[model samples]
Target: MTDQAVFPRLASLAGRLVTARGWKRLGLAALAGALATLSLPPLHALPLLWVAFPALVWLLRGSDRPKTDFTIGLAFAIGHHVPGLYWISAALFTDIGRFWFMLPASLLGLPAVLGLFLGVGTVAYGWARRRWGLTGWVEAAGLALAWVAVEYARGHMFTGFPWNLIGYGWVPVLPVLQTVSVIGIYGLSLLTVLAAALPATLVATKPSWRPALAGLLGLALLAGWGGWRMAGQGLGDVPDVRLRIVQPNIPQALKWKEEAKINNLRRLIDMSGAEGWDRVTHVIWPETAVPYFLSSDSDNPDQAPLTRLLTQIAPPGGALITGANRLATNEAGDYIYFNSLFALTQGGTVVASFDKAHLVPFGEYLPLRGLLPKGVKAVAAAADFSAGPGPRAVSLPGAPAASPLICYEVIFPGAVMPREGERPHWLLNLTNDAWYGQTAGPHQHFAITAVRAVEEGVPLVRAANTGISGVIDAYGRVRGALPLGDSGNLDISLPQRAETVPLYADYGDAVPVVIWLALLLGIAAFRPRPT
Candidate 1:
């Protein structure tokens, strides 16, 4: 045979193999999305997480078109978000039917929106692979960097919804969770994406044995070290302060009715009275525990009953912190009502109050109110409440001062802290999960609260109406909790003051931002020229 003929035959075989590999890559990407979604709540099938990243890398290999890669990535993100966030539909199940459509709308819409970030990352990855030509370990670095950059954008883009970051999957592993004390959740998320993508490099290219072995070893070492740290760290021996958290479990339908206001107060006082409040130093009630505005004119008739009940439970130094709607006339002559946390002296006097700063969109207040339909506006009570200038820390007379978070405010990172030189002893989150019903929404919301405790290195006392009320320690450990659909009071001990601020508390998410910036710059510098 002629030498030229042999060369052409060899080239043809190589082209066929590459074509087959491309098909394999697309299949793998879809599988990865499905697997990753299983690791999220309602399923929490954990082992699937280990294979998710490897599958993504296999699926994207050798794809020349950036748009194709983006579509594949978007598919994976939709799989992960749709099933995981299905509980958002619970809002529609409430007494109001106006938002019935918003449930499925958000389920599909949120993923569609968030998938854009992954799409951007996939495009950048393809661009980097083409320009760099898989040389000098650059392809592996590019893929890892691209994924992390996408996650960063997911954490910050459009006011940021940092939920379901890959790092959160490690919550079940204590050692891995300890890493948050140094790097924060986003930093850990970056690390997690890189580790998961490392195995893909081996399958994509025939690199030196040394680089491949090193990559695998590095991931093992990181996970091992996290395990070690988790084992060595103690829960700490801080003095435990006795606490009583009340979950009135008030139904959402009756919460705001003028007639039901007195009934609601009686239920809370009766539930709390059963606890024999004498021994507890701090008593917490869930958000909107008081149906009527404490400062409103209609309180004249209800005041007598509330005062009598509060005075009856008046224990010498014990303080009661409960959620109430506070009405006040602003300087502009307009009446302003606030979702507030009021510290009451057993004698029924309002000693201190912290108004909620972060308001839920559509829930607390409708955006572009003038544009909404009349029917929609009528059902939304959140419109009546005005946002308080934020970061309010309530100080009880003799006890430790605490930073109070009302309802949805607990989910925002760094937004929960008091001003400099005013850090509180711990975080108190008062929430009403009744609207979520028996769905995973309450559990998911509570998980974020746990992360916040770890992020800030402060014990979290979460009081929820209709479930998941509990005490989470600095390490994200839930001690005593009342499950969903249960109406009860949890009496536990709060950890003493946390002196050190967690890395997240100090530097915020700056590390993740720097990582994302570096990845974008690297991708731009290495993007391939058009053939």
Candidate 2:
């Protein structure tokens, strides 16, 4: 046989093998992303998610083009988000059909959008490879830096949905999570991306064994540093006041109904009574725990029962805080309903109230109402609820001044408490998670609360309507919790004030911003050669 003919046959066989391997890599990447999703709350397989990312980086390194890398990343995102956000569809089963369509859109849309960040990172990695013929340590560092930039963009763009950050997967790994006190969640996310991309450096390039060894050593060093920090940082002293968190477990279908109003108030009052409020310093009810408008209807009929229960449970020193719909008549003669938290003394006298400022788009208020059909407007609330003005911090008599965050507000990183010198001592997050049912919604929601506690260096006392009611210390430790899907009261001690503020609380994700700028400059500096 001629040498040319033999060479062609050998080349064809090699090409087929390479194609098969590429498909395998893509499959592995998808599997890894899906596995990582399970590590989040409601599953608690956190270690599994960490392993998945490195596996994904390894799989993607086999592909040379930007488009191929994007496809693999997209597949992984779909797998990760479909199960991770399945609870979003639970709202669809309610009265609104529009919610069903919107649920899928948001569930798929968010991940799809976030996956673009990964695509950008991978494209940059491929570009760097071709530009400098970089491999091993150089490739790994560049790709890690590129991914950090992507995470930063996802956090800041389009009102910024920073849920399920790679660092959050490290929640179960306490020592690593403690690092948040210094760098905040963004820094941890950068570290996570770096760690996950380390294995890719070894697999993708031909380099001396020393470079691979260095990459391995770097990961070990991070883990070791985290473990040391965890050991050194002990739980600070417990607070003087005892907090009681109440989870009503009310169904969303009947929550706002006129008929259910009386029964719901009675149920909450009964639960509070059972806790023996005399012993507890503060009693908390989940968001919108009261179905009726507390400020409207002088003859509510149910008020007598609620007042009686409060008088019975609330001792002279104790105070009661409950979630209710408060109505205020504006200058326009329209009755504005606010999802508010009201504090009351033993005699049912209103102490102070905080109206929710950060309302959920489409859920609490619809955007672009003028353009919508009249029929759609009729089906929705009369109009969007107006945003409350200023920070609502109320002195709880004997306890610390508490800053209230209703529902989705808890998810926003630094937005929970007042800025700088005006910061509150503790965070009170009241939410009704019943809308999302038993899916990952409640778990993910709870996770955000924990992160908030760590970020602000404030203990969070959270009350959820359906389940996952608990008390989280300053360091994101769940000191006490009620199981999901259960109706119960959790009595726990809040952590005392930490003299020092967390870096995140003071700086507010500044590190991620800097990283994003650096990555942009890096990309602009290096131009890709024409194919």
The candidate maximizing TM-score is 1
User: Which candidate number maximizes lDDT?
Assistant: 1
lDDT string for model 1 (341-398, tens) is: 8777655666788888877666667667789766564233644678887876678755
Cα-based TM-score, every candidate: 0.84, 0.83
CA lDDT of each prediction against the hidden true structure = 0.69, 0.69
TM-score of 2: 0.83
Off by over 4 Å in 1: 1-31, 134-144, 207-240, 257-259, 296-308, 378-384, 497-499, 514-531
Model 2 lDDT tens row, 1-531:
111112354334323322435566566666777897877776677557445755655555556777877777666766776677777667766665545546556668767767777777677766666666544445555656666666667665765666776667666666667667667777776656655555443333242345445655755776677676545455664556777788889888888788887888788878886835667787888888877567433334666555445445554676777787777788989788787887776766666778888776666777677787664532224466767764556677668788889887887766788873557888888888888888888888888788788778888888999978998877677888998899988877777655578777888767556654564465445533356
Q: Total backbone clashes of model 1?
A: 3
Q: Which pairs of residues have clashing backbones in candidate 2?
A: 39-45
